[model samples]
Target: MRTGQQPSGHGFGSPGAAPRATNQNTVLGRAMGKVLAYIALTKPRVIELLLVATIPAMLMADRGNVDLWLVLSTLFGGWMGAASANSLNCVVDADIDKVMKRTAKRPLAREAVPTRNALVFGLALGLASFAWLWWRANLLAGVLVVITIAFYVLIYTMVLKRRTWQNVVWGGAAGCMPVLVGWAAVTGSLSWEPFVLFLIIFFWTPPHTWALAMRYKEDYKAAGVPMLPVIATEEHVTKQILFYSWAMVVTSLILVPAAGLVYAIVALLAGAWFLLLAHQLYRGVRGGAEVKPLKLFLQSNNYLSVLFVGLAIDSVLGLQTISEMFS
Candidate 1:
């Protein structure tokens, strides 16, 4: 059986050690792992919320006769654009991410993805988004998506996030772009309707993000990020949350004249509940009760989802025609 030397009985080779098996299951598992890693780099959960804001804005803009192709194109472009921005942010924040528990497992932080690879991926996605929107939607929408990516990457992530407590407040301007892009894609022009939507999202950002910051205050502090909850007292943070919650509710009502009676009723009821939750958060923090900031955070997410759902339903029902009463 042996030509040059006798084979070792230990393994399928005549070596000192057994050769590892490259079975189909192992090979497939590795491939799937890499695929999931890339997906995680996109932050799909965050993108879900952004798309939620986008489609509803488009529905409101078209009053429901939306061109399916346009919606699909905008969504694809938005996903690519947001992925590019978020991936780059992970690269830039990788250092701090290593120190923070919540983000410690991100691709860049875990070294699952190389920084060079992430950078290239981000740039490619950005370019692809621009081309997709420009070709499928329109020039204005494409340009707006580019601006949104730049604003989040340049203005917020690079400039504001680490420097001031006002980061989320002022930087929220980028998040408001979806409404603008949606409106422009449909009408090719700006108007009071979309701008009011922009303000509602702008005002909502602080409270929504601040509630999350409260839960991660220690992580932000240790990471040297000056999130409001990290730099301010709990009472101060909750009071600010309350203020912004009320402002968001008030700003949402401004859309009443553009959306209609159904929107008005939904906004009123949802706003009342939202404000109540914010008040409870404030009171709990003031009294040092056992309530978690996450309670407010969860309710805030629901509030937005409900409000947007109302918009979609109202658009289908043609209730926007009622808005002309005030207009």
Candidate 2:
């Protein structure tokens, strides 16, 4: 009936052996290592990217007149849900992580954490997240949290990821859910504003991810993942990247009706800049030059962050949407 085993030689053990006293420094170091290992399982950087788009969506939903407590709760709940999904993904991808140099240092891949522990931790966090969001935000937000986690884990990680080059295109749906979760947290309902925000991320995900995948093509190949850069020609993949980049830019414009002048200006200007780099990368691919895709990858992150920050600022500034200005 033992769910888990105690550390060996704790109390009951071999004959006549005295229990070893725990060294405080060693204990602290071990505890700290466990903390970091668990943190790695959550992939904090990716969660940060997901969360970057969240609060702004909340601000936009409520028009900057948000409850501080609600915002805090939503942010925390978003982090929890993302953390759960990431942890479960780490566990699922442990085999591939061991093969891919980019992921080899992950805690599970490195054997710093047991798979069972990570699975239990991930599941526990998911249940806790649902309860927290339901109590702190609303039932709608709570339901969205569960749906996102399930989609990310079951669809993206398990089904679509290794099966096709278009995996990110569809699987990225889960990543686009946070804005919905955020908007739902604020209004307890749905609208076009949040859907516009969702599309922005939906189209943004492929290019941002494909850019990184291009850099790690070998890693994906070695790990048997069918990422676009792994199975397709550089020209073909970069072409798709350019296509998605422009698609994302066009989607950003759709938000102008809801987001207003500040966001529109940033969207037009930043979207142009983002496309410039996307085209530049495409050009490098068409020619024989080194594309250095990570540049575009980094820029895409900045582009999304800038757009959302602009939206938050616009809401705070009480800027009117183009639709409103016309009316």
Candidate 3:
């Protein structure tokens, strides 16, 4: 009859109350941790870049009147698709990832999540993304999202990444899809504007990645991944990085004519600075200096962040000269 006493053989006020609460808390904590891990697996920084590329294409297509709903839908779809692709990459690269310092701690690589569970999660996300895009955005955007996922997961991860130094070159295709998705989400059709933006990102991937690869050449070699630095000499890779960085600057400038005068001026300044950083890397690589590649790698990260910010600024500002030039 006592409030804290158990009835018959039971020891507490409610049968298994304390144990159940403990279990519930444990489960809740685990669920929260898993959710955080899943979010991390989506690579928020990479998604930021993808979104940056997307918004400009949306603005250019709508000519300053981007559809808010469509943009939101496309963003959702893009994030899901990217998360799925990244998850698949983790699953597929588990073995190699374990060997590389850069990826050793990934959920799949470290067995923090079961491979089958990760695969299921990835597939479900991919399907949800497709459905979201088709229903809320447009079929074209949906299809492009699927293609991007397939390209990154199958073409790049399963095949090209292990076989050739040109992995990033071909792999870059997937990275460029958000622009197309953004364009289609706005206009329900593809156009030159998206294509130009796509090309800029496509060319930009190698140098941006190669600089990091140079810093991790030994790890890549140990893992037998055959990244550009692993496949080619330091001098060769550095020169290639410089070449691509220059090309990226030029390609970004193409938007000036298509995007506007504001875009052009921003592109010119950003591109020139990016190229200068690349040139410095080139000189260091030529001189057999290790610090140069790391410096360039960091600079490349800034280059992308700034370039996309500029695109978004131009989009919101609605500079007439740039719009007229593109128009």
Between candidates 1 and 3, the one scoring higher on TM-score is 1
Give the number of the best model, judged by lDDT. Answer: 2
All models, RMSD in angstroms: 3.9, 7.9, 3.8
Tens-digit lDDT string for candidate 3 (1-327): 889965674566656577888899999999998887777666676777677788777877776565777777788888999998888887888899899998887787777788898889889999998999999887988999999999999999999999999999998899989999988988889878788889888888998889889889999999999898987888898788878887888888777765656677778888899888877777876777665577777777787777777777677677675546555
Show where candidate 1 strays beyond 4 Å.
1-21
Local distance difference test values of all predictions, in order: 0.86, 0.90, 0.82
Of 1 and 2, which scores higher on lDDT? 2
| Pairwise TM-score winner, candidates 1 and 2 | 2
> lDDT tens digits, residues 76-127, model 2?
9889999999999998999999999999999999999999999999999899
Cα error, residue 67 of model 3, in Å, equals 2.5
lDDT of 1: 0.86
Give one digit per residue, the lDDT tens place, for model 1 in 115-204: 999999998999999898888878898899899999999999999999999999999888888888887887777788888888888998
Runs in model 2 with CA error above 4 Å? 1-22
In angstroms, give how far residue 256 of model 2 lies from its true place: 0.7
Model 3 stretches astray by more than 4 angstroms: 1-25, 322-327
Candidate order by lDDT, decreasing, is 2, 1, 3
Clashing pairs in 2: none
Ranking by TM-score: 2, 1, 3
Q: After superposition, how far is residue 34 of candidate 3 from its true place, in Å?
A: 2.5
